[model samples]
Target: MKIAVLKESGGEPRVAAIPETVKKFVGLGASVVIEAGAGQGAAISDADFEAAGASLASRADALTGADFILGINGPEPASLAGARSGTRLVAALDPFRRRSDIEAYSAAGLEALAMEWMPRITRAQSMDILSSQSNLAGYKAVVDGASLYGRAFPMMMTAAGTVSPARVFVMGVGVAGLQAIATAKRLGAQVSATDVRSATKEQIQSLGAKPIFVENAAGIEGEGQGGYAGETSEEYRRAQAELVSGHLAKQDIVVTTALIPGKPAPRLISDQQIASMRPGSVIVDLAASAGGNVEGTVDGQTVERHGVKIVGASNLAATLASDASALFARNLFNFLSAYWDKEQGGPVLPDEDEIVKAIRVTHGGRIVSERLAA
Candidate 1:
């Protein structure tokens, strides 16, 4: 099978296939073709891919007659215009939100697989793109927040006086939130975290961070399918707000990573909450791309309101392109390897495989994912 790695046009710095994984694809008995500048953003040169046995081709030539196309993001309409029927395309395509893109895939007679829909099963953990990307975003959030803050992260005793360590509060203790807490703690900041799921409290405490919970969290359940946080009631939001408001006033940095898949990010910090924070405080909202968790956050921009810095860092993982691309490429390789049929010399989607059923957004010229079909 011929596998083409297309250049990402979504302004994302990360590429779907890196040199390390390209070699693996070659080992799997697949001819790998990569766009000339596909790996440029990730500090990889055309020579690097060539060394991995991947032929360098132009964007148009790369996708033409390819059996499987790999990318970091969904392809543009123009790129897919020439895709042949039964061509397999895989990427972190946000099919749930980008319904039109899925339709485009079907219209082009392409079989689309969305990496974001990788089932959160023990067997599928290696292919979890969401967790891999969010882990990088969480670490970047702390680094960005620390750069914005005026004081030091760790407490220092100088000739002048003793400076206390910065206090960091991480909201939504998911993969991203947990990484944020870990990153902040490593920088010598006193970290604390909160989550809608009461079970995450143990995870927070395990990392040596205090776990804050809402007063009315007794009846509210945030754990959803695949252990992701589900949508919460307005009453639960109110209780969460009340609990967080007090902590907001004392925090030097706040990193919000709360997100409900396929829905707008829940607002965790209001304008009033921003106003209550001390001057020069920093807030890094990892959920900025999904309507923001902080009130003043503007996606892809850093803005100051009431003397507090609110950073809406979109595509944080892309900023660490080299490492991000490496991890993401490995994830794609793992997913593809699992379904690769040695006898058929192509990927075989088993009907009964839970991971395959969840991720196969459009197959055989139809939108096949049950969730997206709805």
Candidate 2:
């Protein structure tokens, strides 16, 4: 097996995967080929990969001969237009919205693995791409939000005077929200949060933050299935809006981290809520691409509304690309290892295997994954 690491085409700042890890694949009898200068943003050099026994080649020659390909993002069709058949591609692909891209890979007989579709289970934790990446995004969202706020995050006394602590409100209590709460608490902020699930209140309090329990939240409790949140009813949404309205006035910064699998993120904030915040308050919306939690958030752009800064982070992981790439590389390695049968010298698609069965998109020129087809 020959694995190729193509240069990430966009200015995404993340490498497809690290070469040091690929060296492990090489030691397992797979030849590793990386495009020259492919690991630039991740702070990896060609010499480093060469030391790991990877052959540095041009994109064309590498893709032409590689049996398996890996990337941090999607494959650009221009760079892979004429790739040879049987190139196994694995990455965090947006398979459903980009159906044409999946079709192209299928037409070329490429086995596609959508890392984002990996099941969220205890055994699959090592291979969960969404969790690995969202952890960074969650931490980054706070760092980004704190930078925009006028006041300090933590409180200090006796120095130039007494400094007050900032108040942080987290809208979602999932992986990203939990991280945001942890970061905010570490920064000395008076952190508080709310969620559709009432069960998360204890989890929020465990992180040293007060949980702002919404009134009548029973309507939305336990809506999560498979570690993901399900849609709430309109009655729940209206009641939530009324409950969240009062919390906004006191918050120095607000972070929203809600997301729905395969659907646009639910609207948790309205225009009237934005009007209640102070002038220097900031809202860091992690769900900007899926519409937004803050009203008037433009994806990948920042704008001010009612004197408040709404930060819409398009690719939060790209901000810390080097570390992000390293974490993502580890998850990708764990996932690939599950299917990699070293004794047999090829990937083994174990039927009904938890991790492999969850993310397998197109195998043998057909969409084998039910999550992608339906």
Candidate 3:
């Protein structure tokens, strides 16, 4: 099989698979083809792919002749212009939101797999793209928060004086929120966090951070569901804002990492609360792409409030594409291995297998995901 790496479109700095990974495919009797200059930003060189046994080819040629094609994001609506039929395809694909694109791939006779659809089962752990990418996004979120804080992370004693560590407040104790707490602690910052899930408080405390109590509110509606955060009621939101706003006056940095799957992230910071912050405090909103947790966060830009900086950072994972792609490629390998039937020399059909049932979006030239097709 000829597997091609098309140059990533849609501002994706990541290549679907690295040359080292291509070498693995080459060893499996697959011819690896890469579009020239595809790995520039990742510091991957054409020479590296050549050394790893991949053939250099043009994007047009790769699309026309390859049996399999890879991409980081889903197919670009605009760039699908020249993609041909009969090619096996893979990506996150945002299959939950792009029914038309899923149908388009089916219409083109391309078998589609969405990494986002990987089941949260134990066997599918290695194939969990969201976890891998979210792990990185969590790590980077703290880095952004620490950068914006004008004070030192760790407490230090110097000849001049003793500098106390900055206090870091992390909202939402999910994958990203936990990582933020850990990262802030690593940097010697005092970290505290809050979440609607009462079970996560011990986890937060285990990370050497305080867990702010949220139980005093009369009714919190639903805090989360399906391993994802849920939208809290407006009354709960107001209470949360009031409780968290008080912390900002003494905090040096605040990182909000709450997000609901398939929904805009919940707003965790209000203008009044933000303005209450001491000058030079920083709030890094990791949920900026989907609305934001902090009021006044402009997507892809930084704004200051009362000398405090609120950062709306989108796609923090893209900033670490090299590591991100490696982990993502490994996830794909695990998924493909789970679904691949060597007896047939191709992916299974009827799509009844668990992994198949979990990932197949457009099969037999039609939209198949009940989650999206509905």
Candidate that would win on TM-score: 1
Can you write out model 1's per-residue Cα lDDT over 248-307, one digit (the tens) per residue?
999999999888888899888999999999999999999998999999789999999999
Colliding residue pairs in candidate 1 = none
Per-residue C-alpha lDDT of model 3 across residues 1-374, encoded as one tens digit per residue = 67778778767887877876787776666778888978876778889889999888887777766767777777664555566676778888877567677777888878788877777677888988888888898899888877767678899999999999989998888778888899999999888998877678888999999988566674333434545666666777677767777776788888888887666777778888887888988888988988998889998899998788988988888899889888887776666555555665544445577877767787767877776655
lDDT for model 1, please: 0.89
Question: Candidate 3 regions off by >4 Å?
Answer: 81-84, 96-100, 217-225, 233-235
Q: Model 1: how far is 192 from its true place, Å?
A: 0.5
* TM, every model: 0.97, 0.96, 0.91
**Would you give me the overall lDDT of model 3?**
0.78
Winner on TM-score between 2 and 3 is 2
lDDT of 2 at 372: 74
**What TM-score does candidate 3 get on C-alpha atoms?**
0.91
**RMSD list, candidates in order:** 1.3, 1.6, 2.5
Off by over 4 Å in 2: 217-223
Let me know the TM-score candidate 2 reaches against the reference structure. 0.96
Error of 1 at 270 (Å): 0.7
**By descending lDDT, how would the candidates be arranged?**
1, 2, 3
Residue 42 of model 1 has an lDDT of: 94
Each prediction's whole-model lDDT (CA): 0.89, 0.83, 0.78
Q: Which residue pairs of candidate 2 clash?
A: 16-72
